[model samples]
Target: MIEVYTDAASKGNPGKSGIGIVIKAGKADVEYSFPIGTYSNHEAEFHAVIKALELCKVQYPKEILSFRTDSKIVVDTVEKNYTKNNNFLPLLERIQELSGHFPLFFIKWIPEKQNQRADRLAKEGIHK
Candidate 1:
């Protein structure tokens, strides 16, 4: 199983945003922080998961995915596989599609302090 921790930070609502991801695949641990243009904080959180899945699709295709995030919106929406927010629909669908490539996928919600590494990386992205 691959363990992934992800986070996002936006300067403002629908403003400059980015995503941070930390993936642990066996002995190899990787981290990523990338700008995602302008999006709401919720949208950026969803994108972090999306980008992590996309990366795993190529790097760890057969591995099960276990993701951790501080964003309840991302965790709840992914767990239920549904969201009423229109802006989130596409992001949710993209996650579902990406998740299909793995044998199994799971996401858990954690407190913000528990996600500090990813949080710092996300903030780093915002300034870049």
Candidate 2:
């Protein structure tokens, strides 16, 4: 099994954004950061999840994956504990579709401090 940590950040509420991700398998660790351009924090969060899934597809294809994020909205929506708004329906659909591609998947919400690696990458992405 693989454990993935992810986070996203924005300069403003709907300003320049970035995504950060950390993938861990046993003792090995991988990190990625990308500038996602102007978007709301919520959108950036969704983008981070999408990017994480894409990375997982390439790095750990055909394996069970467990993902962690600090975004309650994203974690709740994907976990089906909360309903997504009309504006986010499309993104939710895409996430759902992406989840189906994996043999096993899990999305869990953790404290922001616990996701510092990804959080730092996301902030770095915003500057780069």
User: Which candidate gets the maximum lDDT versus the true structure?
Assistant: 1
lDDT of each: 0.93, 0.91
Model 2: worst 10 consecutive residues (lDDT sum)? 81-90
The segments of candidate 1 whose C-alpha lies over 4 angstroms from its true place after superposition are none
| TM-score, structure 2 vs. true | 0.94
The C-alpha TM-scores of every prediction are 0.97, 0.94
lDDT of 1 by residue, 9-128 (tens): 999998999889999888988989999999999999999999999999999999999999999989999999899999999999999999999999999999999898899889888988
Clashing pairs in model 2, backbone N/Cα/C closer than 3 A: none
Q: Identify the runs in model 2 with alpha carbons over 4 angstroms from their true place.
A: none
The global Cα lDDT (0 to 1) of model 2 is 0.91
Angstrom error at residue 32, model 2: 0.3
Please provide, for model 2 over 47-94, each residue's C-alpha lDDT reduced to its tens digit, 9 standing for 90 to 100.
999898988888788879999999999988988834648767778888
Query: lDDT at 47 for candidate 2?
Result: 91
